[model samples]
Target: MPRILAIDYGQKRTGIAVTDEMQIIASGLTTVPTHTLIDFLKNYFEKEKVEAVLIGEPKQMNGQPSQSASIIKGFATHFSNIFPEMKVVRVDERFTSKMAFQTMIDSGLNKKQRQNKALIDEISATILLQDYLRQK
Candidate 1:
């Protein structure tokens, strides 16, 4: 089976994660600049047998869409338009970033490491992928 890919979309940087061919074990792929995300995905799709993409959808405490939500939605639309063969799904990402930061702290990452927002983004992508897999 083709693998599943997940994206933690951010304004400046986008984190990427992927599942194995069997759709198990979501792992961090990389963090890339937001502007280059579409090109990056195009290249990655050419190289990998990707079936679908899961993007993180941000929401507020009252269940309203966050500021970043529109950007993510735009990206998701562009992604779908560009790669019509692949399916795109948006998963609610409420506390994945906070959870990733706390996980980094619990994993004994130093202060400097914890300060790396890209790392947290990547971890959040992983978390989002795991959540998608669980639902499946």
Candidate 2:
């Protein structure tokens, strides 16, 4: 089976996660600058067999779309143009940052380590991927 990937997209950076070949284990892959996202994905896809890409959908508490929704949509459009064969899906990403921070604390990360926003994004992506696996 091919691996499924997940993205935690932010304004400045995007986190990436991928499942194993069997699509059972999800792991953090890396974080990249938003401007370099397409290039990064191009290189990654060139080397790996990805089944689909899962993007985070951040919505308001009242279920309205968040301000970042449009940004994600633009990225999705550009991504599809670049990799039309790869499937793209969106998963609800509310509270993922908070969950990542708590996970950092639970994992005994030092204060300095927890301060890395990039790490938080990567972990958030992992969490999103794990949630997706559970849903499947």
Best by lDDT: 2
Q: Which window of 10 residues has the lowest lDDT sum in candidate 2?
A: 73-82
Q: What TM-score, computed on C-alpha atoms, does each candidate reach? A: 0.96, 0.97
Query: What would you estimate as the lDDT of candidate 2?
Result: 0.93
Tens-digit lDDT track for model 2 on 1-136? 8899999998899999999999999999999998898889889988999999999999988988899989988888878888899899989999899999999999999999999999999999999999999999
* Model 1 per-residue lDDT tens digits across residues 1-136: 9999999998899999999999988999999998998899989998999988998899998889999889889888888888888888889999999999998999999999999999999999999999899989
Worst 10 residues of 1 by lDDT: 75-84
- Which whole-number lDDT from 0 to 100 does residue 2 have in model 1? 94
Alpha-carbon lDDT, every model: 0.92, 0.93
TM-score (C-alpha, index-matched) for candidate 1 = 0.96
